[model samples]
Target: MPTGPAATAPRGDLWRFAALSGVYFAFIGYFNPYLPLWLSELGFGAFTIGALVAVQSATRVVAPYAWAWVADHTGRRIRLLRIASTAACLCGAGLLPTPGWIAPHAGYVGLVLFLMFMNTSAMMPMAEAALAQRVSTERGLDVGRYGRIRVWGSIGFIVTVVAFGFWFDRMGLRWFAPGVVLILFALVLACRQLPADKAADEGAPAAPPLRPVLAQRPVRWFFASAFFMVLAHMSLYAFFSLHLDALGYGRDAVGLLWAVSVVAEIGWFLVQGRWIGHGTLERWLAFACAVAALRFAATAAFGASLTVMLLAQAAHAITFAAHHSVCMAWITRHFPGRLRARGQALYTVLGYGLPGVLGGVAGGALSEAAGYAAVFWAAAAAGALAALAAWRVGQAAHKALSATES
Candidate 1:
């Protein structure tokens, strides 16, 4: 059947969003790879940077779900985007205005934490759930097709991260706050172009807004698995620059290593559907966790060989991205309306929040007390536990899904 004009519009909407994702990603990408580097540049010690990073993660733990709950009840997705993005710009821009105000020596930490709470954390979970819901239930939608659109975010991440690191070395971290503000403004414009969700029509049945998300077993397990995995996953990012710095790598080399990680992220997105075709989603997640276990191990052991470090970075595809895709896919397959958004929020809160907060602090303490080697060892240990958790979750999900069919 030929499509109507309205039906054709969402595909157009997605392309618009693809650009937004790229823009949104580009805004934050510079920091994702190099924030720790920046913290080091500003005469920061490891403990102080870790505390600052930990605060941001702590804010994310509660904030995503709170906003997601508001979105679910009000059915006000795009409105949240405008509010979230605008606030994010101001928050990031605040760093430039209010340096060293939080404490005598530790000001940027407070600034970044406020930014994550106000702006960046809410943007992606809301967008991810909205996009996933559209592609999941909408007739004629092809989910596998998302990879190409999402790849632009990776492209944005790589370009900005690699280039800006060089710029930071030359022009300095003074450029970070202002550069981030410009990129976020671009994201706000992109968000303005998104199609709004139509959940509030009078024809729809009345229901209580913001249904509790923990009612589902699959969701609980998925979030728990995400938490443990991300706890381990973030350790690498929160400290790998420091790890590399200790290992005799320069700022430029660290940027390229970070790029190598995201390149693997893009490659994983490219092959994920096919990779899952060859194995169960459970198998893919388990494989990724297992790779994470090794990736951390390699980070600890292979400080001298940049080649091994580069190869280890490639494991991000399996470790972070693949684990994320599996969780999102599970939500799409298992969750219904409103719950889907809430579930994504829960994932953000728990996955990035608790684990992230703890890992940043723990990775720092571990590095400070023992060394970078010990931090990766602890991260690997977390991954080992995550692998077990993933296997348990998969087995449990398989049984429950089968039981539901019967």
Candidate 2:
């Protein structure tokens, strides 16, 4: 059976992990909120923007698993991560619009976005797997401390969004691509420094097949819940900045608003190790789902109210942080040893990839038909569905335990 780490890591390892985490998510912070704004600035319509986002998400559905399969089979997990990170950094340069000659037409920009996201999509799963494996397979490393190291990513996000938001406030949105390239360059260096997986030192066996892990009932329900939970965020992710801009909130303020949500996410990451131990995973997931429902509803109803918007942003603690912690811990416990990388990839595909694709297409159409607010209303409904799925997950957990006991 799998287990959490039992001992503290050296300060050196902790700092290394923290730095890598920070650099990695710095790229995400830049990409997630601003990409659509950049697209809009380039003259893409709402539906076209959604289509581009959907294309990127569709690639994720294939990319992560393909990359993970390579890592698990080749036993070069860290090596693959480094290559992807480097290539992605190079691709970031393509997003910039050249003056006069090429102003980044829809087809060209969409292709670049697809390739860029595809290369970078597997980095998260690979990084998480590498760190978890490093902690578990080594002595004197505490698995419970993973969140503490990971929290730096949230900090990096805050800095990027706020600083870049401010910069873009003064400058134009055209600088967005250059800013992304700079951060991704830093990320490339960060990826090179991660420790190789000790389990693959030599004589390590290939990962066990994926069917057995997928066969578990809790895993299935968790993914079902997670798919909806992530799907609900599509409105916010694809258009939150645009929504704020449309409402007359300047870019600087929009960046700060994004920062506010991540600040809450950081706090949750700091305390999540303790929080995960307090309740059954099912209960934790259920609460997150319920909070997610309220969060999106608040966004739909009171998005113009700064007080209400901040409050909704704060709820990201439960919606993303708590939900994510539960998912990570569950995977750590069940998908031990050689299964770690593939398992993380599977989780990524289910929780993020599929949701991004479906939600992007649907949210784009809905926002165009009704309004941005309608997208959030639909998000609220998805959250409710996720909560119901979490309830089913809880039931399934109870039944499994009872069967094992009997």
Best by TM-score: 2
Clashing pairs in 1: none
lDDT of 1 at 314: 89
lDDT of each residue in 1-406, candidate 2, tens digit only: 1234443446676577788889878887887788888778778888888878777677778888889888777778778888998988888788766423587677888778788888899888877776776555333224257778888999998998898898877888878877878888898888777766555433587568989889989889988998999899887888788778777888888998999999999998887756666787789889999999999999999889999999999999899877887777667766776677788888889888899998988888888999888989999999999999998889988999899999
Backbone collision tally, model 1: 0
| Whole-model alpha-carbon lDDT for candidate 1 | 0.73
Write out the backbone clash pairs for model 2: 5-143
Which digits, one per residue and each the tens of the lDDT, describe model 1 over residues 278-377? 6666666677888898998888888679889988988887786777677777666655566656777777888888898899887888789998888888
Runs off by more than 4 Å, candidate 2: 1-10, 98-100, 136-144, 199-202
What RMSD does model 2 have? 2.4
Total residue pair clashes for candidate 2? 1
- Each candidate structure's TM-score, on Cα atoms with residue i matched to residue i, is 0.90, 0.94
